[model samples]
Target: METKKTDKILLFKGIKLLIFAALSLFMGPTLMTMALSDKENSLYIPLLIVACLICAMAVFLIFKGIKIIMSSMFDKK
Candidate 1:
């Protein structure tokens, strides 16, 4: 019988990613709202684009974080 130990390093990395995702989750919507509030401004398009990118990054980070955490807990080393 084999005992599986959690991979601390990977778990920590996953947690860090999740924290960043949380920040981006908040920031993306805030930026989008700001962009929409000033549609006529020159910065509107750029802000909107950046917001979209941040939202995408937040989703990606969330998935990656969960995957990494799962792997750390279950993967055989």
Candidate 2:
């Protein structure tokens, strides 16, 4: 029973990492474009800041996920 729960937890973590990676991959580029567009708008600065933050966060999450997955894989052996 405990082993089953552990397997489920690991599966959930793997899925979460995958989801984060996908979101980061997709949002990072789109946000970069939006941030660089030259349009006179009131929300430009705020949006750009937000985009920067999201990009940073996405990067962090991706690295973290990769590290976790790699460690888990090696641990299996």
Which candidate leads in TM-score?
1
For residues 1-77, could you state the per-residue lDDT of candidate 1 as single tens digits?
Answer: 98999999999999999999999999999999999998899999999999999999999999999999999999998
Best of the candidates, lDDT: 1
Q: Candidate 2 — what's its lDDT?
A: 0.70
Go through the candidates in order and give each one's C-alpha lDDT: 0.98, 0.70
Query: What shift in Å separates residue 11 of candidate 2 from its native position after superposition?
Result: 5.3
Model 1: runs farther than 4 Å from truth?
none
lDDT of 2 at 65: 75
For candidate 1, give the lDDT of residue 53: 99
TM-score of candidate 2 relative to the true fold: 0.68
